[model samples]
Target chain A: MPNNALLLDGTKVAESIKETLKERIQALGEKGIVPCLATVLVGSDPSSATYVRMKGNACRRLGIGSRRVVLPENTTTEELVETIRELNEDPAVHGILLQHPVPASIDEREAFEAISIEKDVDGVTTLGYARTAFGLADFPSCTPAAILAIMKHYRIEAEGKHAVVIGRSPILGKPVSAMLLNENATVTTCHSRTRGLPDLVRLADIVVAAVGRPRFVQGDWLKPGAVVLDAGYNPGNVGDVDYEACLGKASAITPVPAGVGPVTIATLLKHTVEAAEKYGNR
Target chain B: MPNNALLLDGTKVAESIKETLKERIQALGEKGIVPCLATVLVGSDPSSATYVRMKGNACRRLGIGSRRVVLPENTTTEELVETIRELNEDPAVHGILLQHPVPASIDEREAFEAISIEKDVDGVTTLGYARTAFGLADFPSCTPAAILAIMKHYRIEAEGKHAVVIGRSPILGKPVSAMLLNENATVTTCHSRTRGLPDLVRLADIVVAAVGRPRFVQGDWLKPGAVVLDAGYNPGNVGDVDYEACLGKASAITPVPAGVGPVTIATLLKHTVEAAEKYGNR
Candidate 1:
């Protein structure tokens, strides 16, 4: 049988998104407003540092100002919140992104909640999450927004589709489920506690893998020609679904390195520019 | 055939919950504290007024103080918000309930969002909704909380259950779905936009009807031996599901008038007492 699967090109979609953002950023520049994103990192986690650096580089490429706040390993929640409040008060900063996995001892949720709702460009705040669920959010969690952007770019309709979301993390799985539900999709959220996982996956017209396990979804588990979105970027350039295996069964699929990741960074940059626009106008 | 269905007695569960609240209310009284609930009612909507009054009477029965802030038909969103802010500032008022359908002219969501999170016992605030979604809320929206309270009272575990929730109203359908998902249930949220609703409902081990249409859910739509929760209260005492029809198919079911409604009011009282307990001690 001939290979007929269409690769959902997220990298190309991300480039188109960035192109539009470039014009918006220029308009903000003309208005004497530089869209600024402040990233706060706690402790010395190497991977976290790399993510922060990548985000900062994305902002720079878009001609947006970037601020990095690094705290010591033992920084308390109170200290982290205080730093966020400072960034919130700074007129120059329009958006705040607090890198997750902030020291295990520290209260991470509290720190995330401390970011001002208006400046929560990463959509980490509880208020922001609620807004996103209600279909009233402008800047939802980046990865979920990126997923939607990809689908929109491809003109894939979610209405009336049975979308099985494998994961329920507040940031990735839950928000994306809410987004799809709002877009008129019948959404089922399955997690680690879910039983008969393969059976549930087989029922889906659309499959989203955000369960964090590398290549966890088997090709045999999917309904033939189902649209698969692998949001999980695991080690060794792999994703939640076996790429080669899914290529045979999936009508459309997102590859790991170029899929979801680039679009996610682009969505973040887009949100920062939007935040600055809203701020400048206000 | 003999009906093998279990009637999930919500009234009995409510009585049990109130019995516990009575003791807590008495303890607060010893400390010279009365758990006060302030209800903000805008305009002269007859049904809305009745709901507010019923809630007030329930508070009185529990020995909690009740304050009614009734505004004229011409009240603006600003005035409604001001009234709620006064309740928030009043140390005597531990909880606030804003009756919905507050004139189509006013921004209902904005007014609900004005209620302080601590005093939002009815759980209408965006922050409260988000908190409930994350399983970190003290007081979730009353109807959804009541549904869970009844389920817990009967020791019906939600974990690993395939629960299908009909309707997507923020207060009832959406929150209940989130609560069930947090309980480790594989939850599917469906709404008016959902296609093949009957097929989706048939896949559930548990079904929640919040569609607001009278007798909309037929018995054949349910999986045999499913646990059904009817959260809808339509005019003429009719519920979303045809009660007699569902009784044949469901292993457990909550009836209309005697089920979720009474428990919902009782849950509001419980939340008020809880808020008072938290406040009085602080």
Candidate 2:
């Protein structure tokens, strides 16, 4: 939709990453290690089911084993915790992802706490979030990890650059801000509560749109030569940024359908392989 | 040292806080709550010794209990960890503070990790840092807490404001940035590694100087009517801001010596009282 904009090819990058994951998974298999990811679906949310299926397909293509554990729609908090505990103790399961936005009655934090830090490949556990935020040694959330991978793939050095992240969600914006800070970039996180959002966006050398509002960031808010990473995938194949307006204004920008989305699954597979390598050794 | 600059009245603020602490400590004592602070000093640095002494004197005047544990110059890492562990287990000690920048041979991170979260009144523990950074409910670091307290005292609402923090240290810059963000202010943290620092400062509604450089922020860098919180207490009683140049430019500014310094100690005392209330109940 955008003209003269260097499209960030997440599909191409993700494919290359899958190729690498395939080799890693194969090597693990040769060593009698099966890289396995356990997806725990508490309720039958259609979108979550679709996401889990996509992850499972990606795992199958990479020769990584995946276990899908679907619970009833009316599962209790204690039951979910017990299920997560079982996965944590399962030697065959290397990493675990409990689909987010579970039933309101379920204590999601308590459920996430049930997953052992070693098996928390989804990076939703308190330990994972803490380590990621503190820039300590640990696995990051898959989406944030995907963003990092994209940055690394493009050789977009964050050091000494101004990175403006338009969101402050636990899994995406906050973690990404910490990651960018760790890379020595002067990071600023803007959210709905933020004042003068457009002014902040216009000053960024790198703009990350993760606010989940479709086309919230306009082309006029972008700084020329800024690298734009659209992490928001709203309904109707819309992104948080106006891609068409950002054309020629941004030096590089990720497209809605193919950008960021494919990489999310690829990074999940990479984490699975890593988890297997570490846990399988034990 | 600069001429005709806006003076941050740190001395006056510190005096005011000291008076309040005196009253609070007396009232707590009347209610049989003896607030105790444990200062674990490692490898006696002269400046650190003086600071510890100041805290001890403040505690004495406020009727708060103070314990000074002085370690040998050649103390080992294991010895310091063991010392902190003992203090953490001590029921009588409400707060534990290991004077920062311990000997080059000793690992400060290990020492900080040894203190229990409940007893971490100075809020330097990994748990404290992580909770504050992630916007999770927890005690903030002393300086950041003091900054928030000062803002509250002045009735300066941070919500929907642009806060520029000119530093990025884990204890000061990063923590304060996180606190400002938690208060719903759009926070931008600048450091020696940051580019376009002056431009960022000019856009801030609130400017926090914590870079420890004397008069680093020029008057021209400030926006008119911006609230300036000078956390920089440089040698010779100078601040990071060009106080003279900002005299008429700022809506309100904290003066050096009395601005953030006194509030920091007061906040430390406040946490000490809280720790006592929590741990004492336990």
Candidate 3:
């Protein structure tokens, strides 16, 4: 075991970020402003419901208001968009998050597009994504932002690093690749259609596994001393990269449960706080 | 000499696309609709003026109306955006093209965002860029579309190929990377900040050089049998790739004069006709 591998503790980083946000939240309270996040879930997918509940609970812990808007599985796109627009107009809502994988019958993108850009703290809208790609976003998607937060906390330099991202998801893989590129990393975006994935992974200075499979990336796939960020959320707390297998090769690695997941929720609360600060300034 | 490299002739590909658009333009003509592209120029830069003239000539050849709105070099961003808004609301203008690199004092992106999404044939707006990234744009930026048009013309499959895009500019390099990823090509984006540029290029099955430097990419940088698309338009009709040096290594390559340039203008015309057809259908 090359037990020299440094564990990138995402929970510690999240705690540090939340510590700063806590002071800011209290400052906002003195000014009679309460940072708030409104979460909308269309279907009763148990996992999604739990995710939303977790996020709301996090916001409450930070002294931010939480509003839950649960809709039936049969909710039409029009109705969902209407609900989002009302939230957009609501002065009390600093941030809005619509749970992903809305029912198949709904036009999820249309509903996402309907969220006002100012209140889109979750960064689900197309405009926010573009802003992030252009390096001008105030609030990027929470998960990608969390990844960056982890890197920043660890002082990981991206300049001149060849980072291979093993996914092309709009919010996760794509956004993180763009952010890494902005940070001056040579970014390679690969998806399931890519040929010889293992051979490609062997050349990475930084490997981001976001393929959403359990232990899909073996230790043999990684270059010696490479930094690995496993962004996948598979069942039973297993990450996309085999944590045990990669431990011998990766110079630093994030564990599944305490890794990207908690930082993601913390990043969401940070965005909400930032949005509220902007509103308070106004 | 290995002088048998097949030229990926952009001029011929552009001609075929124009041939298809001619019939569409004539059909619109029958309906008393002239597909008009209103171009806005914010300054008197000589190159910008020449580009506007060239685009207008191309439109004239295709029986499309070209409207020029030239502002003084000292025009403010608000003035530029207002001009774009007027063109956006004009019923006669089916498409709008805003020549880029507006004066440094201007908020170019803000002005671009002012153009209505419907009339933004040039696809310079943030929303348009996001759509392009997501593979859902009605009209993507012309130069990137031009590169794809050339590839589709040659029937070179992007699936499973490793494509290295040597630029990260918003309208060109970045957009093309997204488009290639959408086509299932593993895309690596590199810029001036990238280390080992030549090594990265050598691994690519398809290399797109948009670095804007004259003859910056040498033949030694390419793998034998690689497809090279020189998107850089430098002074004196030179391209980003060293044509003579690359000829022996490239199995297929685009020449500067008849390469990506002609195809780009043709794509602008195609987008205009498409926009007009949409309005005509209404």
RMSD of each: 1.6, 2.9, 1.4
Residue B99, candidate 3: how far off, in angstroms? 1.2
Tens-place lDDT per residue, model 1, B191-238, is 888889999899999999999999999999988989999998998988
Q: Which candidate, 1 or 2, has the higher DockQ?
A: 1
lDDT score, candidate 3, position A125: 86
Q: Interface RMSD, all models, one decimal each?
A: 0.7, 1.6, 0.5
Interface RMSD of 1: 0.7
Question: Candidate 3 falls in which docking quality class?
Answer: high
| Cα displacement (Å) at residue B130, model 3 | 0.6
Of the two candidates 2 and 3, the one with more favorable TM-score, higher being better, is 3
Go through the candidates in order and give each one's DockQ: 0.86, 0.62, 0.91
Classified by CAPRI criteria, candidate 2 counts as medium
What does candidate 2's lDDT look like per residue over B1-282, in tens digits? Answer: 322434446565556666766766666667677889999888768988988988888777777799999998899999999999888787788899899889999988778878888888888876687678666645679999888888877788999999999887767887898889889999887888998888889989999999999998898998888889988988888989887778678888888777888888877777787777666723
Q: List residue ranges in candidate 2 displaced over 4 A.
A: A1-3, B1-33
lDDT of 1 at B277: 85
lDDT of 2 by residue, A1-282 (tens): 234868889998899898877777778889999998999998888888988998898888778889999999899999999998888888899989998889888988789878888888878765577677667745788888888889899998999999999998778887788888888899998999987788889889999999999998999998888999999988888999999889779988899989999998898888888888877945
